[model samples]
Target: MILLFGLFFILLIIGTSIANSMFISSIIYMIYYGLPLEMIPQRMAAGVDSFTLLAVIFFVLAGALMNRGGITTRIFTLAEKCVGHYTGGLAHANVLASIIFAGMSGSAIADTGGLGAIELKAMKDGGYDEDFSLAITGASSLIGPVIPPSVPLVLFGVTASQSVGDLFNAGIIPGILLGIIMMVVNYFICRKRNYGVSPKASLKEVLKCFIWAFWAIFLVVIIRGGIAFGVFTPTEAAVIAVAYAIILGLIYKAVKIKELPSVIKETLGTSVSVLYILSAATLFSWILTYEQIPQTIAGYLIGLTDNALLLLLIIMLILLFVGLFMDITPAIVILTPILLPAVSAVGIDLIWFGVIMILCLLVGLITPPVGMVLFVLSGISDVPIAKISRAIAPYLVASIGVILLIIFYVYLMTLNPSLPKLY
Candidate 1:
């Protein structure tokens, strides 16, 4: 175990990719144990050999298609029309837009990369400070993974063998709460900073904008409604999302038929990279399992405290720390196996725990060192990482607050089972 992790962290410090780091570390661990080398490919193959993972690919493609189809612009326009008149109106709109976009994209990087430019440009034009604009942009993107149709949730489902539908259901309230809390924080900050607001949109204009963006927004309705009503599984929702995106693109003339090949190629590249990480992490995870690492860790955790609430708090802190160094996908894949036993041992609901886990990890996206959202925004706006880090403090705290609220909610539900379960 020491040999494996030491080499992995050393490789990470030197800038080795996560996938390569895990693969190399696992191979060395196997050699040290005199395990047959052939098991490597076998374990990697088994890792991604899930029907559920198809949702990951299709969802990636759908998000790419929607971005290419100009759906993000419509979504932004609609949000602006709805909330562009209030103090810090554009900031509120930024959060609202991300919440809506989250339904379709389900990936934080996708939301940041897709909707971010539009939000920043609008805020800049509206006279918002550069640091504030960039801060909110990065922070709002975190909502993407917490909402339904989320890529991370899908990965969590496959990793923990939990129902993706229940996970989606579980996330609805928390995701919306995260957005609301961020917006509330934005309101106070913008008021103190005196950020300006635009003239309110007339009801006629708001209606027109909504009509224009309706199809794009309805994608979420289809995905969430379908899953909630059992009309289709999450995997099927991905396919429908792709088909709907293509159709919506054609209707808007935003995505030409010829442009699809490029979109597909982009999707393929992204999907393969994610799958590669999963495969390698699976091999690494398999080694841990073979050595009974999960059981040992679970035992130690239970020994420390069998109290469900306390164990969850410890798990949340560990996830937050891990998120500082690891990308969310590989982190979910590697840690879910090791941590689920500990979580289950404490009688915490796995479905609720999955949402809690994802929420905690999402904060890492805006945090320093490995905050991918921060890095994306910094590259786009040329803001210093230091400034971005400082600017994001309020929203980061808001996220943690929402997470704590959920934890307390779960604990309360445990005390009284009559409350509707998060699942």
Candidate 2:
């Protein structure tokens, strides 16, 4: 196993794509261990065979379609009209837009790539500091993976063998709390910097923006409401979301029919990238399970401390560190099997743990040295990664605080049977 991981990192250091690196390392491991070489293909195939994975594909498609369908502009307009009057109002609008966009697009890369461009432009044009604009854009993009229709949550559910709907439920409160906390942090920063604020929207203008954005807002309500009411599964919700996006595009005449092929092509590219990584990670995980890696790690951790809270904090630290170096999808796929057993041994609910794990990993997405969202924003805004990383420090602190709050909340809920059920 050490040899396999060594080769994997060596491949990564040499600039191999994550999917290829995992596949190649797994192949070498099988050859060394004299396992059936054919099992590699079998495991990879099995990785994407789940019915749950279908949701990921559809959601990726939905997000891509919505991005080109003119939803983001309306979302941004509505966010600005609603919150642009506050200090650092555009920053507040950035966070709010992310919260709204999060419901439509579950992928962080999508949020940063699609909306980051627009938000960064708005903030920069509004005379906000470039570093601050880029930093907040990247930070807010983390919300994409925390809210409902989240791709990471779906992957976590399948990888951990938990209910996707339940995981979605667990994310709702944490997602909103994280956004609110970031907004608070933005409020203070804006006040300190004396950032410019927009004129307050009139009742008429507010109503107009709201009416224009009503369909986009309804997307979230319908998806969440449908799942909560058992109107459809998450996978079905993705299909519904796609249909809804298409209908909106047609009705608004914003997304041209000629644009769909490219939209679909982009979606296919993204879905293929994710699915391939999943397939590779699935094979890698099989190797870990076959060697009882998760059990050994779980036993060692359990031996260190029997206190669930302490153990969870320790795990969060480790995941946070890992997130700094790895992308969230492969991290979730590879770590879920290893960490799930450890956390379950301490009597933590997998549903709540899923939210914690994902949120922590996502914070890494905004962290330095391979933070994907940071790179995305930097590319879009022409800002240096170093400056963006520095600017993101406070938001990172706020995000970590949100994670700690979730840990405590989940722990308290475990102890208090009177608390309302999250799902």
Candidate 3:
């Protein structure tokens, strides 16, 4: 296992793609152990042969379609009108727009790439500092995977054998709470910096913006409502989302039929990238299981601390450290199998644990060194990575606060029988 991880890191440092790194390391481990090479392709095939993964394919397509369909602009316009009068109004709207956009697009990259451009432009035009605008945009994009229809949550669910609907449900409160806390933190920061507010929209204007955005907003409600009411599975929800996005595009005349080929091509590229990582990680995880590495680690951790709260805190810290170095997708694939048993031993609910794991990992999207969202923002804004990292520090602290709150809430729910389960 040590050799396997060492080889993986060496490959990563040399600029190999994550999927390729994992595949190379797995092959090395198999040869070293004298295992048959044939097992590799078999496990890789088994990795992606999932009914639930169909959701990932369609969701990726739906996000791509919506990006090209002009849904992002409507959502942003509505967010700005709804909250543009608040302290740090654009910052607040950045976060608000993320929450709304998150419902439509379950991907943080989608949120950062699609909406980051518009939000940063709005902030710059409004006389905001470039670093500050970059920070807020990157930070708020984390909300994309925390809300329902989240790609990470779906992956986590399928990996852990938890219900995807339950994971989505569990995320609602934490996602909203995190957004609100960030908004409050932005308020103070903006007030201290004297960031000016936008002109308040009149009641009629607010309604007008809302009316224009109603179709986009309705997509969120329909997806979550359908899942919660048992009207559709998460997979079904993704298909519906694609259909709805197409309908929206046609109705608004924003998405022409001619553009779909390119949209589909883009989705295929993104989906293939994700599926490849998942496939490689699946084989890597099988190697770990075959070595009993997960059991060994779980036993050691369980023996290290009997206090569930302390154990959870320790696990979260480890995940945060891992997130600093890894992308969330492969991290979810590799870590879920290793950590789920340890968490189960500590008496944490799998659904709650999944949410917490995702929240911690999403924070990494804005973190330094390998922060995917940071890179995305830097590319879009032409800001130095260091400047964006420095700007995002306070927002990082606020996100930590939200993570702590979730940990406490999970503890409370575990203790109280009368507490309602989001599942």
Candidate 4:
């Protein structure tokens, strides 16, 4: 047990990739235990064999197709028309655009890499502060994986063997709350900073943009409605999302059939990287389970407190700490098993817990050191990481507030039978 984690951390500190570090450490653990080396490949194969994981690939492809297909611009334009008139209106639009795009793409990286560029450019042209613009863009992208059709939620469902549909249903309110809180935070910050606001669009113009962006907006309804109504499985919804994206691209004349190969190539690269991390992390998690590490940890946590709310707070802290260093996929894959027993032991709802866990993990994307969203936005805006990190602090606080709010809501519901259920 000591060797497994010790080697893994050392490798991480020495700049090894998370996937490679887990893969190497697991192999070494197997060798040291005199376990069959053949088990490595078998475990990895088993990890990737999940049918639920297929949703990750299709969602990645759907996001890429929409990005390449120019669907994002229409969404952004509509967001601007609706919200660009208030103080810090462009900033509000930045958050709104992310909320809408979150329905289409389940990945934060995709949201950052796709809608982010358009948003940053628009804000810059609208004469918004660059730091504020970049910060909101990075922070808002976190919403992508919290909303329906979320890749992280899919990964969580598969890892914890929870229902993806239930997770999706549980996430809807919190995800919207995340955006609303960010916008509220933006309003105060912009007011204090005296940020510029755009002129209000005429009602006719707003309707025109909505009409133009109707197909783009409808993607959200299709995904959330399909899942909510049981019209399709999450995996099947992903396929429909891709097909819809392609058809919309053709209709908008924004993407050509010939352009699809490039989009697909990009999708393949992302999907392979995610699957590799999941596979390696699964094997690593399996070895930990073989050593009974998760059980030991869970027992220790349970010994500390039986109070469900307090236990959840401790779990959230641990998840936030892990998210600081690890990417979302492997973090979910590795920690879900280790932490889930403790979560279940406390009688917390798995679906709600899954949503909370993923949201906590998603915070890592905008944080320092390994924040993928930070890097994505920095590359897009040419802003320094330190600047982006500093700028994102207030919004970060807003995000944690949302998490706490949800936790308290669940806690209150636990105390009151009259309260509605999460799902």
1-423 per-residue lDDT for model 4 (tens digits): 889999999999999999999999999989998988988999899999998899999999999989988789999999999999998899999889988999999888889899888998888898778898889999999999998889999999999999999998888889899999999999999999887888899999999999999988899999889988989999999999999999999998999999999888988988899889988998999998988989999999999998889988988899889889999899999999999898888777788889989989999998998999999888877889999999999998999899998887776766675788767
Q: Which candidate tops lDDT? A: 1
Local distance difference test, candidate 1:
0.92
Model 3, residue 195: C-alpha shift (Å)? 1.4
Record all residue pairs in model 1 with backbone atoms less than 3 Å apart, i.e. clashing.
Answer: none
Evaluation by TM-score, superior candidate among 1 and 2: 1
TM-score of 3: 0.98
lDDT, candidates in the order shown? 0.92, 0.90, 0.90, 0.91
Clash pairs, candidate 4, are: none
- Lowest lDDT 10-residue stretch of candidate 2: 414-423
Q: Candidate 3 on 259-347: residue-level lDDT in tens?
A: 88888899999899999999999999999999999999999999999677787898889989999989999999999999998988867
* Residue 362 C-alpha lDDT in model 4: 91
What TM-score would every model get versus the actual structure? 0.98, 0.98, 0.98, 0.98
Compute the lDDT of residue 112 as modeled in candidate 4: 88
List the candidate 1 regions with Cα displacement exceeding 4 Å: none
User: lDDT by residue for model 2 over 1-423, one digit each (tens)?
Assistant: 789999999999999988899999999989988999989889999999999999999999888878877899899989999999999899999999999999887988888887887898899899999999988898998898899889999999999989999999888888889899999999999999998899999999999999989998899999999999999999999999999999898888988888888888988988899999999999999999999999999999999997878888999999999998888889999999998888888778889999999999999899888798888877776778899999999999999999998888777776775787566
